[model samples]
Target: MLRDRLLQMLPEDDAAAESVEGLALTVTDLAPGDLGSWLADRAGQELGLDVAGRALQGGGDAWAVAIADESGTSVALDLATIDDADLEALGAWLADPAAPIAVHDAKTASHALHGRGLTLAGVAVDTLLAAYLCHPDQRTYDLGDLTVRYLQRELPTGVDAESDGMLDLGLDGDHSGARTAAARAVAVRELAEPLRTDLASRGATALMAQVELPVLATLVGMERAGIAADVAYVEGLAGEFDAAVERAALGAYEAIGHEVNLGSPKQLQEVLFVELDMPKTRRTKTGWTTDADALADLFARTEHPFLGNLLAHREAIRLRQTVEGLLKSVAPDGRIHTTFQQTVAATGRLSSTDPNLQNIPIRTAEGYRIREGFVVGEGYEGLLTADYSQIEMRIMAHLSRDEGLIDAFRSGEDLHRYVGSRVFHVEPAEVTSAMRAKIKAMSYGLAYGLSAFGLSKQLGISAGEAKGLMDDYFDRFGGVRDYLTGVVDEARGEGWTSTILGRRRYLPDLTSDNRQRREMAERMALNAPIQGSAADVVKVAMIGVTGELERRGLASRLLLQVHDELVLEVAPGEREEVTDLVRTQMGAAAALEVPLDVSVGFGRSWRDAGH
Candidate 1:
C-alpha cells in the first residue's frame, strides 16, 4: 500500500527515491479548513499539505488523513485516529506560517474548520478554482472525475463503500478515511501545479487568485445572509396573481365569444387561425405558431382582444410561478438562499439556482409588487441596490471607440435622445419621443447584430425605414459598425473570440458551410465580447465592492447580485457610507474610455431601492 501510494504521488521518481527521501517536516494539529483539501508536497521546497475525509469524522474536527505533498504514503498521518496531544504535537512544526495548503472547495472546508475552532496559516491552493481558471468550459470538476481525467488514477473501490453518499470503510476499518484523504491530497498536489502554470501563462493568475479566491469567502457570507423574503407577502402576491390569471382567462373567453381552454395551445391555434381567420403566422412542427412572440405580433397587427388577454394570462401565470417558487424555497431563517454558480455561463456571468433571483421581472407594475416581498430583514436597516447604468452600451462605445457614442455619453445628455437627433438631423431637444424610442431600439439592437427585419418587427416600422434608420445611425457611428464587423472577421480568422479579460469563446460555426449557422455564429461572436466584457466588469465590481466593504469595517452585507445590479442589506447608521462605498468600488472596477456610471438607491424593499 505504501509503495503504491508513493508511486502515485511521485510519478517522476521511482519507489527507491521515496525510500531515501523524506521531510523533517512539522505540522500543527489541523486547525481550521478541514472539510476537504489537498496538499502539494515539495520534497526540498516550501512545505504544503493535502487533506480529505469527513469534515467531522468520528465526531472530531479533523481530516481522516493529512499528507505532505509528493510523499503521501511515506509521511502520511491518520489524523482521525490520532490522539489530541499527538495531533497537537504533530501540528507544532506544520504551524509554520510559511507552509501553504491546497483545498478543493475553499470555503466549505475553511468554514468547517473555523466552526471547529481551528485555522491554517498561509495560502491554500484551490484545485477546483485552478481547474476553472485553466479551462472554464469544462462542465463539472468533481474530484473523483478530475482525479481520473488529470492524473488517470481511479479512487480505490473499498468494501461496501460509496453508498447513499457516504464511503463506508470496512465495519472496523479505521484507516479508510486516512487512505482516501491521502490519495485525494496526492491527486490535488499533482493537479495544482499545471493549472497554476496555465493561469499564469494566460495572465489569469491575478483574476483567479486575487479576484475569485478571495471572493469565495464573501460569496459564502452572502449565501448565508440570503435576502430575507416576506413569506406572507409572497403568498399574498401569489394569491393576487392567481386571481389575475382567472380574470385574464375569463376576459379571453369573453373576447373569443365562447368558453375555451386558454391553456390549450391547439384550441388557441384553432381559434386564432380557423375561427378568427387571422393572418397566418410562421409554421411550427405542430401547426401555425401560437407562441408568445407570434401572439404578440398578432396583437400588434390586429389589436385582437383575445391575443391581449392571452398575453396577460401567460404573464400572470409566470409571475405566480415566481411568487410560489420563492415561497417554496424559503428557509427556516425566512430567507431565500440561492446558490450562485460561477462557471455556468460561458461569459463569466454568475447564475442563480434554487429559485433564480435573476429571472424576476420588473417591467410591469405587478412585477414590482413581487419584488416588494424581498424586503429588509429583521435587524437590517433597509435594502440598497446599486446598478451599472447603460453598462453594455458603455462597453460597446469603449470597444468600438466610437467618438459619437462616447461623446453622447460624455455630453451628460439623454443617450437615446442624442442618438435620435443625429439619426434624424434634428436638435437633441427636438428629438421626439417616437424618434428617441426608435433610436434606443436600434442602438441596443445593433450591438447584438439585429437585422433590419427584426428591428422593423420590434419597432413596428417598415423594413425599409428600419434599414434606413440603421444606415443613418451607422453613418454617424461608423466606428461601431467597423468594430462590430471586425470582431466577426477576427473570430472567423482565429476560430474564437475573446473578452477584454481574455475569456475566450470558441466559434467554429463561423466557418460552417451552412449559411444559417454561419450567420448565427457571427451574431454570437459579435455579442460575446460586448456581453462578456460587461459580465467581466460586473464580476470585478463585485470583488471590489465586497473587498471595500470589508476594508471599511462596515456591517452592511451584500445580499444578491442580479447581473448588473447588487442588492445590499444596509446596517443601521451605515446606509450613507455603504452607498458611497458601493458606487466608488463599482465605478472603479474596470478602466474604460467611457466611465462606468453607478446608480444607487435605498429603500425598505428591493422595488423601492431598484427605482
Candidate 2:
C-alpha cells in the first residue's frame, strides 16, 4: 500500500515507475514500551536514521527520530512523550558502536542528539559527506535532490494522500510528520550503498571513514565547548573601535573640506575623480570603480590625504563590525560557539560560520587586540596554541621531491634564507634580509600559481624583474619546475588531481576550448594538491591530538582549529604534559620527506598564546 502511495505521489516518469516496482515500504509507530524490544531485536543490524528538529545548534525542545531497519520496516519515535527509562535506552542503542547506522548528515544528527542530552555513534556512513566526496564540485547535496538523482524518485512530502487528492495509505490524523521522517530515513538507507560505491570509485573511502567521520565528533566537541570570551573586554574594544571609526570619518571630511557620506561609493567617486580631478580608476557601467585596491593605488600614486583618511575609515569600520559580531555572538554561558562546515570547501578544508572565528585577522595589531578577548576558561590554567611553520612549502618539497628544497629543509637553516643564498650565489649567513624577502615571496607564490605580473604586483617590482627572479629560482630548482609542469599534464590526462592522501579533485575544464577557463583550471590544478594536502594534514592532526588526549585521560580539551593552528585549553597541572602530547601528536600527523615542524606557545589568552 505504501509502495502504491509512493507511485501515485511521484510523477509518471519511467525511473520513478521502476523505483517502487519491487520494493516494499512499511511504517509503524512503536510505543515507548515496544522501543526496548525493537532495539534489542535490531542489535548489530544496520539502520537508517533521520532527526526532525528546528535547527542543529540547540536541537529544539520538540525533536523526534525516524528509523528504518533492514526489513524495510520504518518506525518513528516522538522523544517528547518518551519516559526517562525509554529515552536512556534509546540513547544507549544509538551510541552502540557495534551497531551500524546510516544518516544523511551525521554531524547535524549528532549535534542535535547532543543538544538533547544524547550521543550518536555507530554511524557507518554519512550520506551527505559521501555525496560530497563523490561530487566535490556540487554546491549543495540536499537530501531531496540526492534522492531524485540516485533513487530516481521524488522524496515523499508526508501529507495524507487522500486529503491532498494523492494516493494515501489508509492513514489519518497528525501522523504526517512521522510519516515524512520515516520516508527520509528510508531514502538515506537506500542511498548508502550507491554513495559508498561512488566514494570507493573516487578512492576516498578511507578519507571518509578515517578522517571525516572521526573528526565529526571532534568538531562537535569544539563547538559545544566553545572558547570562553571576556565580555567586558570585548565591549570595551567595540566602543574603542567605534570611536576610532568616527575619528577616521571626521579626518576624511576634514581632508575633503565638506561632510559627505564616507560609506557612499558614489559620493566618494564624485569627490575623487570629478571634484579633485584625480585620475579615474577602471570604469564600470555605473561609474568609475572605487574598490579598496583602486583607492590604495590612487593613494600610492598621488599620496592624497583624503584617500589616506578614507582607507583608515574603512579599516576602522571593518574592525568595528568584527568586534560587534563577536560581542553579539557571546552565548549565555559566556562562550562563542561557531558552526564548522565540513563540505563547503572542495579542498577538504573546514570552514566556520555564525560568527566565523577563522576569518579573524591574525597579522594586524588590531587583530591581535581582538584575539585578546578570547581568554582561558575559569577552570583552565591557560591556553595553548600549536602551529605548523612553512607546512605548505614542506608539502611542496615532498610532492616535487626537489633535492635542493629538500636539502634546504633538512639543512636546519631558515628555508627562505637558504634558498635566497642559493639564488643570489651567496652563503646562507651572507643573504641579506631583502634578498630573503624576495625569495620568500617567490617560493610561496609558486605553489599558488602566481604569474610574473602577480608576483610583481605583490612585491612592488617590475614584471621583468619578477620574471627573471622566477627563472633564476627555477634554474636552481629544476625539479620543482618539472614537478609543477608535470602535475598539470598528469591532471589533464587523468581529468583530476590527487592530494597526498589520495583525495581527488576533478577538473573538467582542463580540456575546455576557452583559454581563460582552462588556465584557471590549470591554476587550480597546481594549488589543489598543495592546499588540500595541508588541509588533510591538519585534519589528521586534530584527530590524533584529540584521540591521544582521550586515551591518556587528560582534562585538557581542544578549543578551536584555524588553518594550520590548533588552540586548546590547558587543564590545571596538565600544561607540560598536554603541550608535549599536542606536539607529539601534531608533528607525526603526516610523514613526508621533510619533517613537520610544530611551534608551541602558551598564555592566558589566545593573543598571548599565538604571539
Candidate 3:
C-alpha cells in the first residue's frame, strides 16, 4: 500500500515504530486540488506504490486521513469510536519526534483537530505567512508559482472528492490539490531555516518580530476603519470637472481649426511639431515631444494659442479622468483600499497600488479638486494631514554636514533666498524674486541630473549663461557640490548605499561604461540616500505612531502616506492628541542638524486640510 511504501522509505528504526503505531492526518479546505495527485504520483514514481487502485470513496469532506498498520493494512478506526488506548497510541506516534508528521491542509486541519485531544501542533508555522515574511517583494500567493520557483518539477491539480476506495488515492484528472499541498509542504520545510538566516543577517529579525509582524495584523483593522468620503462633494466636483473638460475640448478644437483627440499624444505630436513646424523639444520612445514639460516649453516658445489651449485641455481631461477613475475604484463600503507595496521602488519608498492614492494630483488648481473626493468618514470629525517641510534637503544637509547648508537652516533663513543671495553675490534681503526662482530651479534640478543645456532650455537663457549660473552656484556652495560628487563616488566604491537605518539600495550601474547610463546611475546614487533616509524616517514614525495609538487605546487610524506626508483619519475629539502624537513621533524619528519641521492641517475634507 502507498502508506506502507511511505513508511518503508523512512529510516528502519522510525519506520518500524511508526508502522506499529498509527498516525493521524488532517487537511485544510484551502488545500488546492492537485495536492493529492502530486503526492500519489511521487509515491508511485519514487517509492514504487500503486496508489491508482486506492481511490478515496464518495464525497468526502475537503480533508481526511486514514490510520493504517506498518504493512499498509487498513485499520477500521473511527475518531468517535476510538478508545483512550487508540488515542494514546496515535498521539505517541505523532509525538515520536522521529516520525515526520506531514500536514496537507493547514486551515481545515487546524479547525477540525482543535480540542480533539490530539496535540498535532505546527500549523502555526504557515507557508504563506513565511513566504510573505521572507520576501515581501513578491505580490502574489499562488502555490504553483512558489513551487516552480523553489522546486524543479511540475505538480498536479484538482482533488477527487467522489471516488471510493480503501487507500483514498487521488484521481489522475484532479491534481491541483496534490500540487498545492506539495508546494506548501516544500515551501514550509525549505523556507524556515533560510528565512531565519536572512532575518538574522539583516538584523531585521527583531524589527520583523516586533513591528512588521504586528503591523500586518493591524492591516485589516485599518482597512475596516475606512475613511469616510464626501459623496456629495465628489459628485458635484466630478460634474464640474466634466463641464470644464468639455469647454476646454471646444477651445482646443477652435484653436486647431478642427476636432482631434486631445488625449492622444501621437496626434498632438504630429499636429504641433510636424504640421505646425514648432521646434521639437525632446524625443520620447515613440518619437514624440508630447511630454508635459516639453509641451509647456513648446507653448512658451511659440506662444501658440493652440498649444496653450491643448495643454489646458490635457490637464482638464486628466483631472476628469482621475476623478472618474477614483469613483469607480472605491470599495462598496465607501472606503478606498490603496494597497501598500513594500518593496517596489529601488529607493525603498512604499508605493500604493490599485487607484494609486500616492499620485493624486495636488500641484495645480484643477488637479487639486480631486482631493475633495476624499471626505471625512462618518463619525470621524476630520482628516488631518502632516508633512515634513523640505525633508529631503534637510536629510541632505544632515548627511553631508555641509556647514553652510546647516547654518542656513539653523539661522532660520529662507533656503532659496540664501542660495539666491549667495549665487547673485547680494545680501539676503536684496535677493530678487527672479534670483530666488532661478536658485529654486537649480536646487531641485541638481538632484535630477540637470545639465547646462537642460538648464538653458528651462530658463530660456543662452547655454553660456546657464553654464555661468551653474558655476556661480557651485562656487558659492562648494561643499554641497563636493558632497554630491562624493556620494556617487562612495556608491560606486561600495556597490550600494545605505540610509540612516541601514536600509541598503544597490547601484550596480554606477560604474557602467555607457556615459548616459553611468550619469543616470550617479544621479540615482546621489538622490537615493537623501530620499531613502527620509523614507526610513517616515516608516519609523509610522511604526511609532501605531504603537502609541495602540498603547493609549486611541481610535484614530493612519489612512494614507504620500512621499513626504502622512494622512490620519481622526476620531471625534481626538484630533488634538493625535496631532501632537504624530508630530512628536515624526519629528524625532531621526536626528538631524537642521531640525525636522512638521506642518499640520485638519478639516472635513482633504481640500480643507491643504492649508
Q: Candidate 2's residue-wise lDDT over 238-337, tens digit each? A: 9999998999999888888999898898998889989999998989898999888999999999998999999888888999999999988988889998
Q: Which stretches of candidate 3 lie over 4 Å from their true place?
A: 1-175, 178-182, 199-221, 301-303
Cα-based TM-score, every candidate: 0.82, 0.92, 0.73
What do the candidate models score in CA lDDT, each in turn?
A: 0.73, 0.84, 0.63
Mind giving the per-residue lDDT tens digits that candidate 1 earns over 512-562?
999999999999999999988988888888888888888889888998988
Better of 1 and 2 by lDDT: 2
- In angstroms, the error of model 3 at 381 is 1.2
Candidate scoring better on TM-score of 2 and 3: 2
Write the residue-wise lDDT of candidate 3 on 25-75 in tens digits: 222211232223323333311110011111111222323333222222322
lDDT of 2 at 361: 74
Q: Which scores better on lDDT, 2 or 3?
A: 2
Minimum summed lDDT over a 10-residue window in model 1 is located at: 23-32
Models sorted by TM-score, best on top: 2, 1, 3
Model 3 residue 143 lDDT score: 46
